[model samples]
Target: MRRLAFAILGLFLAAQGQAQSIVPAPPQVAAEAFILVDAATGFVIASEKPDAALPPASLTKLMTSYVLANEIAEGRLSRDEQVVVSENSWSQNPVFNGSSLMWIEPGKDVTIGELERGIVIASGNDATVAVAEHIAGSEEAFAELMNQHAERLGLSNSHFMNSHGLPDPNHYTTARDLAKLSAAIIREFPEHYARYKELDYTYNDIKQYNRNKLLREDPSVDGLKTGYTSEAGYGLVASAKRGDMRLISVVLGTSSPTARKNETRSLLNYGFRFYETARLLDAGEELEKPRVWKGQVDYAPVGVLDEIVLTLPRGKRQQVEQRVALVDDIEAPLAVGDSVGTLTLLLDGELLYQGPVVALEAVAPGGFFARLWDIILMWLASLFGG
Candidate 1:
């Protein structure tokens, strides 16, 4: 009876391990571009042709949100600031053209908050124009600001021609850049992002629903925007959080809204279903001590630059291990935060996260006598060419 119980326990453990290895199924969509990313760690969970540059359509609003949120955070702009609609914004540029309202007459008043809601909830090209004109004095100037912010955000595959994300030869972004931009908005502007999740917002006595259908489909999805144009096709940038794990999925150039939502949902679901976040090392946890030469202390304690965390699947922890590599005998006079080495977490021989190991405490060369002796020895060795 004891032997049989032990055998059953072993089988149960083995079955649990097998279950943990199961990964979420791949998304089914006809999108020309797609990307899935773990929002917390900025890890790329999956991607298919993520770098292909395409017209972003209304997805360009993500950049607008980034700029607006930054301005608000810095107190440069207030949400209640009233903006007067300009004729140029109403006129619309012929070169970069898309749907808009002839009814948004010039000389109308709208608050900054309304302008944001107009664009996000209504996908109003006119609202984008109004906000751009109010903020940067003109859409041309605003486009320059958008490109600058893109550069600052390290969006290598993005360029902005207009604020409204109308089809312009120059207005382009890739799936990866869009995902990065979306993640930045959520991380840097949590307060501003709250508006994106609003299912319906009323402006000028007109009720408008958010174009992002996933918000209605999945309660977990809270913030994001959707975009489309004749040339750009249907696109959606959606973000969702389940527990501490959040993911951003971008699907661009899909055939239709239903397809975009389905693909985005699949990508996000795969991320949540398969990946499990594990905290390996807490902040200030000493990972190792490396030998030091000619220092007051014989060795220096090295620790994670920040808390070490990873998003992985269950049962994979058994295959995970950290390898520490430190500089061979760090010289004296090392300062805190100095890079000493690196701690690499590996799973199945694949590198997951490589973090810098830094000096936790400063180590100066010993007494004056010790320093002088070291200098003399170095000089003698140089003179003798030894």
Candidate 2:
């Protein structure tokens, strides 16, 4: 295979003799585990022990909401469809004495959508159970579905034991895993995700405010969740967008509500202050057209499967480079999405984007004489070390 290197045009480029600014060291954050990731590229701008599995408190409700989101997405449930609250999920259940509850009464008046708001904005354990029972027959069965989603989303260290996330020895997740889940919720289910930003929600004439204080403190911050349990400590997952960049910050096992909020804000500030994100290439913007041997067409179109985005240190975006290593004698029939080459975007040691360069169009096998001639040509090229 032969490789081609070129500068990415039209992106921000540093001018000659411009004022030099080195990215400052990441700020120290007070938390057991924390991470800041660029939402579009899922790049870890900074992290500390982000994979340590620990109790997630109500953060586990994020997964419960995720499962509910999936049910809605797949047409199994609708937001407005009513779910009858069971006696077990009543607000006054003794099992939920000190935890959050949405004041749900055992009745048919509640909807899946209402419970989504209760679960997210109110952090209501009763609401979580209602939705869980309505979807999976019981919380235990619902947890199995949550694990299925955890497996699908590549939440390697996260497991769900219940829908409410009260506390259990086996119920734990990593900071990194929660960040991934938060990003997915924002990206995949905006309708449901919008529930997280509501400062206050009312059910049964009781008003409850969202526990995620960042939603009120930072205008850029929109929707996410907060958690607190004696065993889990205070935790928060926040997502904020500034200009072209959106970031997800996770701070877990902090000392207090104020500590979680401050630590999260600190992480977000550090990431935004030090890094920048931009799209390097649009999907289907042809990057290469390489020769296709033994095919009806002599060439195959090659490009990215999706748009290429990158998060880089401040001022270093200008120095980034693009490289495509093309297949030298790509034999086909080639499928539309078959890998044609490997594309890399590099700035210093970090290649914020590294993904398959795929065939934009398919190539069917050539007729007998065309194949034979191409084979002979390939042989001659090999003989001369071409």
Best by TM-score: 2
**Model 1: per-residue Cα lDDT at residue 47:** 91
Candidate models: Cα lDDT each: 0.80, 0.88
Worst 10 residues of 1 by lDDT: 1-10
5-100, model 1: which lDDT tens digit per residue? 011101223334354576755766679999998887878888999999999998998898788788889998998998888766663545435474
State in Å the error of residue 208, model 2.
1.2
- The TM-score values for the models, in the order shown, are 0.84, 0.88
Q: Itemize residue pairs with steric clashes in candidate 1.
A: none
Q: Which parts of model 1 are misplaced by more than 4 Å?
A: 1-20, 91-104, 290-300, 328-331, 368-386
| Residues 1-386, model 2: lDDT tens digits | 47564547456455677765588777899999999999988999889999999999999999999999989999999989998989999999999999999999985599888899999999999999999999999989999999999999999999889998888999999999999999999999998888888999998999998888888889999979999899999999999999888999999999999999998898898888888897778888788788889999987788887887777777776677787887677888988889877888777547556788889988999999999999999999999987
Give candidate 1's TM-score: 0.84
Pull out the clashing pairs in model 2.
Answer: none
Query: Pairing residues by index, what is the TM-score of model 2?
Result: 0.88
Model 2 ranges off by over 4 Å: 1-21, 290-301, 330-335, 349-353, 363-386
